[model samples]
Target: MKLNVYADKMSQPSRAVVFFCKVNGIDYEEIKVHIPKGQHLTPEFEGILFFFLFDEAINLMQKLPAIADGRFKLFESHAILIYLACAFPGVADHWYPADVFKRSKIHSVLDWHHSNLRRGAAPYVFNTTIAPILGRPLNPQAAAEAEIILSSSLSKLESFWLKGNGRFLLGGNQPSIADLSLVCELMQLEVLDEKDRTRLLGPHKKVQQWIENTRNATNPHFDEVHRVIMLAKERQQHQRLKAAKNEGGSNMKKPLVSRM
Candidate 1:
């Protein structure tokens, strides 16, 4: 049985998992779980649709980027990326690498990502932009707090993981799952208004270069997986403009027009 990757492109981790699969040429089917529509709340049991109703089922997964490889079921994007790198035959070595020491370092980076960087990046984007789209009021105080953490996290990456002479994280010439995951997380900031986005990301020069390098390494596949977020950004911008015209200069959170 081919691998089935259930994911929502809008999700940061989900995009990383999907992009990893696509970049490595893993044979898999993408099962989209559209979160904005609440599809994740009622996921269909793939390959066994009628085995049990979604309401009655006790063990059915309820998350983006869950996967079923034959009988093996897995969630969590980092685990999925590592699994694909090790499970697939044609995956490049630099992704996870064979050296235990190097792999351990990669693990360290991933650990740090969730503990530190993600704490700020995810919520900052959520409170600042995604909140209004979800019919929730924007939380400037929370966004402000998250920005401080996000900026600090970027500085750590610059001084530590990205300190060496190489382009990628830990001074490596190639991209790894850590790089992919972290970069994808940062992509959430793309939806921010230009001034805010620049203010947060501009000062980290090494981090900026590393993002570009990883992006180029993954290329078409990287951008392909990220198309949804970019689309969301475009739609939000258009909505703002139309809202301005229609509302006659009222500065309020206009509803995010559904262009997905």
Candidate 2:
């Protein structure tokens, strides 16, 4: 199976895919899609999107239908994750537990991720961390609202999700899908300002340690992952600053920059 990933190295979902691929020692060609350049909106992307209109990760999903002529198109990072876990069962047991109760527990974590953590936390990361770098600070009210939600969500994860000592989520055992989602989300939080850092990752020792552990999972690749994630965030921040300058020069109404 040829796995062609169209991803911006800086995107969290893309980073998750990269993390998954590295963990599995999977050989694949990574096609960089420059989100900052708006390459995702290009004609080629439009064509790919048209093929898989229902799926945001169209470029990768569309290939399955074309190559095998089966119901192969897939979308959503979570869905792709489940499919990969089932398809490559031997690679890593952490993503999909074999035990029935463990699997159910993992599903619960994923469901929680979709409804709570992802919903609450992602907007803050996007608005403050990415959008500012993209020439726009988020709307004042929206950013404030997102930060509130993110704080509460972070608190919940630290207080409840990390209750055990198994090295990751799932009640003190090895990492499961829950841990993966949490790790990816935490990666976004690492780019935040002091207040957010304190509100999100500061008090969460487990989450903090998990981040450190994932960084050095494999000798050679550990440093690579750290380098890639940090570089991506820095580049995005720089771009946002440049965009902010351009926006100011253009006299666009700027949202008052404030940290909650």
Candidate 3:
């Protein structure tokens, strides 16, 4: 039986899953779930939708980017990556090496990511970009706090994880599941204005290089999966320009105040 994958490319974890499948030649059917449209909440999607955890909130049923292979079912991006790497005999070893110590380091990076890198990056992007798109008020204070955390996370990622001459995390020459996971999370910032995105990521040159390396390594697949985000960014730019034009026209229409 073929592997069935339900996901939305716009989602970080979902993109990670898609990249893994594409890079590894894993044959799977892609099922797109439009989360923003409330499609995931529908009864038909209850079991296949992936839900992101916010604060203390958790929904046990939401599972997106999920896989169903014959009788087996799996959720969680890290687990799915590891499972694909291990389950397929022809997959490259570097993805999740058989060497115990190297594998342990990869695992460590994955675990630390949830609480540190992802914690900082995901919230920062969503709060600043997604919330506003959904008609929610922007929270400057919260976004600022998340930015500080994200900056610290990037620093650690550069100094500690991608230290020395390594192109990927944990000093690995090849990209690992950890690299894909964190990179996708950071990719969420593409929705921001170019200046803001550059300002947030510019200080960390290593991170930037790593992103390029990962993209090069993954090639067309990575770019293909990220097309959704690129489209969204373009739409955002169009909206901003239209809004500014409307405001300018309104201002011109207002009569000037004459001095008495």
Query: Which numbered prediction scores highest in lDDT against the true structure?
Result: 1
Off by over 4 Å in 2: 48-71, 216-223, 232-260
lDDT of 1: 0.84
- Put the candidates in lDDT order, highest first: 1, 3, 2
Cα lDDT, model 3, residue 222: 85
- lDDT minimum window of 10 residues, candidate 3: 50-59
Note the Cα lDDT for every prediction shown. Answer: 0.84, 0.64, 0.83
**Which predicted model would earn the best TM-score?**
3
lDDT, candidate 3, 78-157, per-residue tens: 99899989988878999999999999999999998988888888778877878866567878788888889888998899
Give the residue spans of candidate 1 off by over 4 A.
43-61, 243-260
User: Could you tell me how far off, in angstroms, the CA of residue 140 lies in candidate 1 after the best superposition?
Assistant: 1.6
Score every model by TM-score.
0.87, 0.75, 0.89
Residue 226 error for model 1, in Å? Answer: 1.2
Candidate 3 backbone collisions, by pair: 49-63, 49-64, 50-63, 50-64
After TM-score superposition, what is the CA distance of residue 65 in candidate 3 from its true location, in Å?
A: 2.0
Cα deviation of 129 in candidate 1 (Å)? 0.5
